[model samples]
Target chain A: MRRVVITGQGTINALGRNVAETLQAMRDGRCGIGDLEFQDVERLSIRIGAQIKGYEPEDSFNRQQIALYDRFTQFTLLAAREAIGQSGLSFSGELATRSGVILGTSGGGMNTLDENYRSVYADGKNRVHPFVVPKLMNNAAASHVSMEWNLKGPSFTVASACASSNHAMGQAMQMIRTGMADVMITGGSEAMLCFGGIKAWEGLRVMSKDACRPFSANRNGMVQGEGAAVFVFEDYERARTRGADILAEVVGFSMTSDAADIVMPSKQGASRAIAGAMQDARLNPEDVAYVNAHGTGTTANDKTECAAVADAFGHHADDLMISSTKSMHGHLIGGTGAVELLACIMALREGVIAPTIGYEEPDPECALDVVPNVARDVKVNAVLSNAFAFGGLNAVLALRAA
Target chain B: MSDSIKDRVIAILAEQAMLEPGDVSMDQSLEDLGIDSLGLVESIFAIEEAFDVSVPFNANDPTEGDFDISSVKAIIEAVTGLVATQAA
Candidate 1:
């Protein structure tokens, strides 16, 4: 089997607009979550979210381009441009034919949907935008990304709620390993910080009005966030032959379903994914030095995740560092795992463990070393990123230092 | 007045456990009655709704919760105490 390596990474999240800025924000433990300023903010119960404030669409896209690009699609194109630029690969011939774009997004075009809905219902307009269907499709981001970069192979989108990105990347890695593609543009993007998005989540009673304090005892719930993170995954041999700058190695991935509940997380199911990733990577429990947890700060998620970690790693659970950057970036939902992978890459590349900010009190149930409150400078060999979404779907990705 | 809290809580627990109310002993833990984490949380929600009182039961650390649930008896006692306090 061929080995897959990440050659480039880029992001435009509430934390920052690029990899460097995002990593710096993580190191500083800055909270990007704040008051969400959008239309009809006063009508919602939860007005706070991690929004990319002051973003001008015109700055990135022209008027004609903006008409077709939804907020989520715009995020995808911006992140993809940076990632492909860093990858230094101008695809043509077989590379272009084999390479493809696979992205994860729950809300493909929330801004578009909300706008069209208001135009038709609230404003009493008879007709809405003609391209509403194309703009609002879940695969719009992936399709535009492929068209923009000329990636003509195996392009698609994954929509397993929060686990979407990890699942999408896992599939991309497998395609490369199986010699289907030498290069893949893979990751996820989400822009759900809108009135309709928040209004829908308000019914679930899971949105936090003020903050996201994952793994903290006093944590209320997860706060919504909007952004995208895209990566360049290439075959290790090709990258090495071309003398490319490898960021990290994608070693293992596994996904599992609880088959028990729709909303509440399952400890056994989560444990299986974690243990399965280690097994697939041919790694012992001790080989993992860090974990980017799916710690959503909700009592059900935090406790269930900690229990799953303990069950999978046993004694090592006490020693290995684990943290939830959701505390800082808020929960990006479908795009969360893609952005959280940045924390893992930084950990392996720079030996910096991003902290779970806003941790005021500790609960024994979540007794792992969460690297709370501040970043830590520690050498890490291998790390795991956990994405446990609603509906009991869990995906775990394991990566090693390049 | 507080005596009714125990019966109501036990009934809620029995429903969650999918067992008869009379079969729910005060000594049996929720786990002993086959009540999983989901059941426990749902039971808490139901109890809170039925009693019209907030139960400080942390799903993360049930043992350390403000409302006790060591056993069916403890949960009943906790609810009775809460009801008495609310009445006062």
Candidate 2:
């Protein structure tokens, strides 16, 4: 099987608008969760989220584009542009035909849905926009990315709740490994901080009002976050021949189903996925030095994830470092795993592990070394990114330095 | 009016707890009634819709929220207070 490697990455998240700015924020250990700024935010019981602060669509796209693209699609296109631009590849002939796009998102055009619903139900409008259905479809972002980049190969979107991004990226990697595509522009995006979005999630009661303190005894719950992250996954040999700047190698990926609970997590399922990724990558437990945890700061997720890690790695669990960048970026839901993979890439290439910021107190249940409150500078050869969704869907990816 | 409010609160709690209103006890805590955290939130929503009064409850830190949800009796009293304040 051919190897897959990441050639370029870009993101517009709560942490930053691009790869450099985001890595810098991680290094500084900044808190991006704050009072959300959007229409009807005052009406929400939970008033804070890690929202993109000063983005203006007019500055990035034309008026026609803005009318057709939802907030999630806009974010995806922006990140995709940056990633493809950085990769320095212009698609024209067979290269274009041999490339595709796969993205993950739970709320495809939530902003459009919320607005149209408001206009019809709240404002009593007789007619809605004709583009509403096209804009609001779940595969809109993936289709748009493929169209923009001229990719004709396998193109689709994956929506497995919180594990969406990881599942999408894993599929992208497999496509390149099996020679289905030489390159794939893959990642995830989410724009669910609107009134309807927050209202729907509020019903779940798994959100924090103040902060996301993952693994902290004083932690309340996960905070909702919005934005997107995109990457260019290319064949390793192709990237090497073209002298592309390889960021990290996609060494392994594995996904599993709990078949246990719909909303609650299962440790056995999570551990098996983790173990399965390492086995696929042909890496020993000792080879992994860091883990980007799926720590959502909820009362149920943190301890359960720690137990899963313990079961997966046995004695090596205590030696490796695991931290949740979600504490800083908040939980981006479907797009979260994509952004957290940046942390894994950073740890492998830059040797700076992002901290689980807002970590106030430690819990014995989560006894691992959760590089708390501050970023750690340590060299790491390999790392794992874990994403466990609400429906007991778990996906883990193993990465190594390029 | 207060009696009506109490009856509505009891009905909502009973619905969330999956018990008949006759089977519910005023002194029983939400947990004792087998209403988990999500059920408690749903009960709060029912109360708000029935009375058109917002309950200042944040599920992240339920105990610290201003809305009292300790027991059926306590929830009824809190909803009554919110209704009165909104009316005023």
Candidate 3:
């Protein structure tokens, strides 16, 4: 199998708009969870979320494009443009046909659904926008990215709840490893921080209204975050031949299912995915220096994930550095794993560990040394990114320094 | 009115458990009613919306929560007190 590597990365989330700004925000341990600005905010029992501030879509897209693009699609395209721009790849004939786009987004066009539903239910509108169907489809973002880049290869979206992005990237890696695609624009996006989105999640009662403090004993619950992170994955040999600046090497990936419960996380399932990722990479437990923990701040996820890490790494778990960037950026749902993967790249390339910010009191069940509140400056060679979704679907990706 | 509150709570729990009100015993634990964690959380949301009073139950550590869920009777008592406090 051929090696796959990340050539470029870009993101627009609660923390920052792009990779540089996001890396700086992570290094500074900034909290992006705050008051959400949208229609009918008071109706939601869970009011606050990690909504992107100062985002003016009109500045990026024109009137026609805005009407055709939903918020999720817009986020994906914007992040994709940034990633493609950084990669300096101009897709044309064979290259364009060989490359593809795969983005993960749970609520593909949630805002569109909210607005169209409001029009009929609340405003009593007889007719809705004709482009509503095109605007709201799950594959809209992937299609747009493929069209914009002129990619004729496999392009689709992955919807696996919170693990969507990791699943998408994993598939893209396989496509490249097997010579199915020379380059793939893969990542995830979400724009579910709307009234309907929060209202639906509020019913589950897993949301925290105030803060997102992962692994903290007094942590109320996970706060919803929305945004997108796109990365350009290319064949390692091709990237090296082209003299491209490699971000990090995608060494291994593994996905597992719990088959136990729907919402409740399984320690054994998560452990299997974690251990499987290292085995796929052909790396020993000690070789992994850092882990971008899934750490959703919910009680079930935090405790179960900690136990899984213990089971996976055994004694190595004690000294291993793990932090959930969700503490700062909040949980991005389907797109979360993609954004968290940025932390892995940063750790492996920059030798700086993003802290699990907003940490206070630690629980005995979560005994791992959670890098709390402050980013650590240390040399790290390899990193692991973990994504455990609601339905016990766990996906882990292992990366090495470029 | 207190009996009505208890009945409404029972009805919500019943709806979640997919059982009849007669089948749901106030003395039975949530587990005995076949209400798992998700069911319990949904029941809390339904109760909150029905009464317009926020329940202090935490999904993370239910033991530390001020609202009790030991049994149907306990949930009823907790909801009744919360409703009473809201009314006052």
Q: What is the RMSD of candidate 2? A: 2.2
Query: What's the lDDT for residue A364 in model 3?
Result: 95
Ranking by DockQ: 3, 2, 1
Order of candidate numbers by lDDT, starting with the best? 2, 3, 1
* Evaluation by DockQ, superior candidate among 1 and 3: 3
Tens digits of per-residue lDDT for model 1, B1-88? 3557778888999888889999999899988989986687788778767877666654544554478777999889888777667657
Q: After superposition, how far is residue A261 of candidate 1 from its true place, in Å?
A: 0.5
State the lDDT at A224 in candidate 3. Answer: 87
- Against the true structure, what is each candidate's TM-score? 0.85, 0.94, 0.97
Give me the candidate number with maximum DockQ.
3
Tens digit of lDDT per residue, candidate 2, span A258-367? 99877889999999999999999999999999999999998889989999999999999999899999988888899999999999999999999999999888899899
lDDT of 3 by residue, A274-314 (tens): 99999999989999989999999999999999999999999
lDDT of 3 at A347: 92
lDDT of each prediction vs. the true structure? 0.91, 0.92, 0.92
Best candidate, TM-score: 3
Off by over 4 Å in 2: B1-6, B26-34, B56-60, B66-88
DockQ of each: 0.13, 0.45, 0.63
> Any idea what lDDT model 1 has?
0.91
In model 2, the Cα lDDT at residue A227 comes to: 90
